[model samples]
Target: MNKTINDPNSPHSIAAEFGVLGSMLIEEEIAGEVIQLLNKSCFLVPANQVIFEVMTHLYDNNKPLDVIVLQEELRSRGLLDQIGGSEYLFSLVEGVPSAGNVEHYAHVVRDKSILRQLMAAADEIGTLTRSGNMDTEELLDRAEQLIYEVTQKKAVNEPEHIYNLLLNIFADIENSNHSPGLSSGFPDLDNLLSGLKGSTLNILAARPSMGKTSFALNIADNVGVRQSEGVLIFSIEMSKDQLARNMVCARARISPHKLSYGVDEKEYKILTTDASVFAQAPIFIDDTPAISIREIQAKARRFKTKNDIKLIIIDYLQLIEGPKEKKENRQQEISFISRKLKEVARELDIPIIALSQLNRSVDARDDHRPRMSDLRESGALEQDADSILFLYRDEYYNKETTEPGISEVIVAKNRTGPTGSVKLRFIKEYMKFMGISYQKPT
Candidate 1:
C-alpha cells in the first residue's frame, strides 16, 4: 500500500523513488548502478518495491529495460495488476526527465531505508529493555550488534579486475618495507611468518607442560612493552593478576616460585621497576573463564573500536564455549568455535593467536613433540588456521637433556610462507621465551 504525501509520520521519499525508477527506465545502464546502490527494501511503497524487483529480474536476464518488458515481466510474475498495472509503469518513466541523477536519488532512497531500520532497532531495543530478560552484559552486546549491523549495511563487496588487484598488491609490497603487519616480537618467527599478518588466524598448540601460555605472554609483553603496540589477551585459564605476575617475573628474569615465597630486596627493586614499565604498556587482559565465542567477538570488537588493539590472543581454545545448541556434539561445537574465531579475526582485520591444547597422543610418541593432528578436539583448527605452530621443549619430557632451556617452535603449517622450525631460549623459572641468541651482558 502506498501512503499519501500528507502522511508525514513515517520516513519515506516518494519523489526520490520515482526519480530512481524513472531514470532506470530512461537509461538501461542506470539500472545496474541503482541496483547496486539500493535494494528492494529501499523502496517505501509495496508497489515500488515490486516494480524494482521485476526490473532487477529483467535487467539480470539481459532483457531490455522498457515499459513493455517490465510490464511483461510483472505480468508473467502475476504482479502487474496488483501493482496498478501498465499505467503505473508508464508514470514511472514519465515522472523524471533524466537518468544522470539516478545515483543521487538512490542515495536518498538508501538514507530513508537506513532511517526506517534505525527506528525499528530503537523500538526493538525498548522492548528488550522493558522485558529485562537478559543479563546486562549480554543485552548490551546484543544492542551494540544491532546498531553495528545498521552501520555496516552500506558496505558492499563488488567484483574487481585482476589489474586493480595487482595495483593493491604492489602498494602493499612497497608499504611493507617500512610498515609491516604487527610483529610477534620474535625475530625468527616474525621472519618466517611475515610478522603475523592481519586478518589471519594463527594457531599455537602445545602439550600440557610445553609453556604455550608463557610463549604467548612473552609475545604480548614484547609487543606491548618493547614495540609499544596495543594488545588484547583473552586469558581464559589464568587470572589477569596471574598473567601480570608471570609477565613481571619473565621480564625481570626472577623466578615465579621464589616470588611466591617472598621477593628479596634486589628482586623487589627490579619487580617494582618492571611493574612500572608494564603498567604503561598497552596490553589488555580479560580473564573471563569459559568465555563464549559470541562474548569474545563482542568484546574483541569493542576493544578494537576503543583501544585500536592490533593483536588478540586467546589463552587456549578448548575452554571456549560454542553454540549452546551443539552441546551434545563436542567436535561440532569446537568446529563452530574455531570457525567463528577465524571470522572474528577477518572481521576485525587483526591477527588472532589462539593457543590450543595438544592431544594426549603427543605423549605417546618417543619425542613427545606436538603436530597438526594433535590439535585437540577439532580438525577444523587445522583447516581454518592460516598458520599452525607447535611448541616443543626437550627438557619437559627428558630429565638430563642436552637441549635444556631450549624450546622449538615447529611451524607445521604456514599458508603464505615456508614451513619450518624456530628455536627459542626458554627460562622456566621466570616463564619467559626469548630468541635463541638472547644473552645476558657480562
Candidate 2:
C-alpha cells in the first residue's frame, strides 16, 4: 500500500494529491487561467517552456509588455480571484503568479507542455503520419476560423463587415474608371487581350536579346505615364540608372548605344534634357541582385505605404530565391519562388509583371514561337501566373527574313481574356517597342 501510495508514479499519494490540487488551482478563478489558456491553446507545454516562448517573442519584438494589459487579459479568461474565494491560487510574485506550483499542477494541466512536446515529437515520426493522417482541408478550415476569431477579437470595434463592403465599392469604382478596355500596345493584340488587369500576374518570356526586357519596360513606362500612377520595378538584371537611361533614350527617340557611348552635340542636349524630365516620372526601380521574395514583399509594402504603388514589375522570375530551404533540384526552388511571387501580388492587391527566359527548345523549333512548355526550370510559373506573354522578334531569328522589325506578343496563357498574338514595332537601336500605327504595318 505504501509502495503504491508513496511511489512517484503512484496514482495515489502526496505527489498525486498535489497533481490534483494543482489542477484544481488551475481551474479556480485566478491568474492561473493564463497558464490554463496557454495550455489549451498551444497545448500544455511546460510552464517554463511557455514562459520562454512568450519572453522570446517579446524580446525579439523589443517592446516592454504592459503588465496592466496582461492582468486584464488574465481577467478576461475568467481567471481573476473572486472576492470571497475559497481556493488559494499560488502566491503572486511581482504581478505574475509563482511558477513554484507548476509541477503539482502538471497532471491537471495534463503536463500540457509535455503533451505538446509529445505531439511535436509524434509529428516527426514520419512523413506519412505527419501529412496523411490529417485531413488538410479540414485542418485549413479550422486554422482559418481560428485566425478570423483572433483577428476579429483584436479589431472588435473596427466594423470589418461594413468596411469590407465599402472597400469593395471603392475597388469597383476605381477599376471602372481605370479600365483599359480593348486597348493593347498592339492593335491586333488589343483585339485579343484588351489589356492587363489589376491583381494579375503577367509573365513575358523569350530567349536573350528577343526584346523581352524592352517590351516589359515599354509596358511599365506606358502604365506609369498614361495611368498617372506610380510603378515599382525590381530589376535583378539591371541597375535603376541603367533602366532609366534606357527609358530616356527610348522616349527621346535616340539610339541607346550612341547615348551610352558618346552622343552627337544636338543629340547630347536632347538626351540630357530628356533624362531630367524622365527622372521626374513616377517610376521607382530597385536593382537588388538575387533578392528573396520576402525582401521584395517588405519593400513593396513600404512603397505602397509611402506612395500609391499601382503596378509592380519584377525583371525575370528565375532570379528570385525561395524561402531558406534545401531543395532537391533547381526546379523546386523556381516553383517555390513563383508561387510566393503570386502570393505577394495577391496580398498587396496589385498587378505583378514578371519577366522570364525561355528554354533553348524554343530556339530549336522551326516556328521559334515560345510556348507554355518552354517556361524555364518550373511549370509552377505557368500554374501561378494569371497571364503569360511570349516575346518573339523575327528579326533575331532570321535577319534575311522579310519581317525584319516586327515582334509578336503572344498571349500563351491569360486567365482573364482570350489568347492570341499582338504585333508591335521593335526598334532595336532605341531598345523600344511601339504600338504599330492603326493604319497598317508598313
Candidate 3:
C-alpha cells in the first residue's frame, strides 16, 4: 500500500539514499539491480544523485564501481569537490556494510520519488487551471494524463528468468482450451489467423463498397454477444444508431431495405429478439467524428479500466484525426498515428482492429485486389500492424463473375502465422458476412 504524504519537499530520506549507494559500491552485482530499480531523480539529495549518475556511467562502460574510479570520473567532470570529494564516498560504504537490505532501501527511495512527483503534478494542474487558457474538458483530460504518466513511471524494469516464464507457459497450456486468443466468431478465419491475439494491431483495409464496416461489426457482435466478452467500437465514420441498426439487421437476417416497408410477424420477432440480445451485450460504442488520437487514447484507457474490454475496433483509420503536433506531410502524420495506435494496443493489452481505406492504385490493378502497397496515405500501417486483411469481392468488380455473392478475405500479411484467403458469403441486402456455406434459416 502507498501512503499519501502531503509534504513533497520533506519526503527525502538521507539514510535510504546512502544505503543504496553504499550497497552498489560493496557488491558490483547489486549495482545492476539498483540501476534498474531507481534512477537519478529518485534521489532527493544532490550528492547522492550525482554519485549514482557517475556509477551508472561506469557500469555502462564496464568499468569498476568503487570509491577510486567514481572519484576520478567526478574529478574529470569537475563535480568531485562540489559533491564533498573522497570522504563522502567512503562514508557511504562505511554506513552500510552489507548489501542485503539494498532492495528494501531502494523501495523506500522510490516511494518517496512517487509522492514528490504526484505533488508536483498537482501543482502543475493548479497552475494550468488558474491560467484559464485551455478548454475545461481538455484541461481535465490533460491533468488525468499527467497523473497517469507519473504513476506509470514506477513500472519495474527487472528481467524475468526464462525458467519462470516457461513454468507459466506450461501451466497455461495445461489449463487452456488451445485457444490462446479471443475467437473471431468465424472458424476458418480463426484457423487462418489463430484468432485475434491480444496486444496486437490488426489492419482491415479495403476500397469503398467492400463491406469493411459490416465485416468488422459482425466480428464485434460475435465477440460481444456470442462470447459474452466486452467489446469497444470507435465508429468514426458512422453514428451509434446507424451501426446498431446495421448490426440488428445483420444478426436477425432481415434485409435493411425491408425495414422501410415494415416487417411481418416472424421477421419482427427475430428483429426484436436480436435487438434484445444486443441491448444486453457488453458492447460499447463511441461515434465521435473527427476525434484525435489523444482523445481515443484517453477514452480507450477509461473503457479498458471500467469494462475490461477484450477487443477494440476503430472504424476506418483514414477518418481518425492525427496527433496534435504538426507533421511535415500527410504521410508523416499517418505514420505517427499508426505508431501510436500500436502503442495503445500494447498498453491496453488487447487486440485492436483498425479499419482502413485502400489507395486507388488497387482499382487500376487488373485483379482489383488490394496488396499491402495499396494501404492509403502511409506505409507505416503495413509496418506497424501485426496482421493485414484485405476485403475483396469479385461481384463488386464483375457482376457476371462465377463467385457472385462471395467475398475473399485476403490475408496479405500475418506476422506469426501462414497467409491465406478465406471465402465468406456476403449477404449484400442485409449488410452481413457469414461463412461460405452458411444458409439463412427460414
TM-score of each: 0.72, 0.60, 0.71
Per-residue CA lDDT of candidate 3, range 31-145, in tens? 8888888988788777887999899889977899988889899999999988898899889888897999999999999988887778777878888999998776568767877
Per-residue lDDT over 88-157 for candidate 2, one digit per residue giving the tens place of the 0 to 100 score: 2232222234445554444434443333333333334333345665554334433433333332222112
Q: How does model 2 score by TM-score?
A: 0.60
lDDT of 2 at 363: 79
Rank the models by lDDT, top first.
Answer: 3, 1, 2
The residue pairs found clashing in candidate 1 are: none
lDDT of 1 by residue, 127-201 (tens): 888999876766776787767656656433456668768988899998767436677778888888988878999
lDDT of 2 at 165: 82
Give the top-scoring candidate (TM-score).
Answer: 1
| Ten-residue stretch with the least lDDT total in model 1 | 1-10
Better of 2 and 3 by lDDT: 3
Ranking by TM-score: 1, 3, 2
Q: Which sections of candidate 1 miss by over 4 Å?
A: 1-143, 149-154, 440-442
> Top lDDT: which candidate number?
3
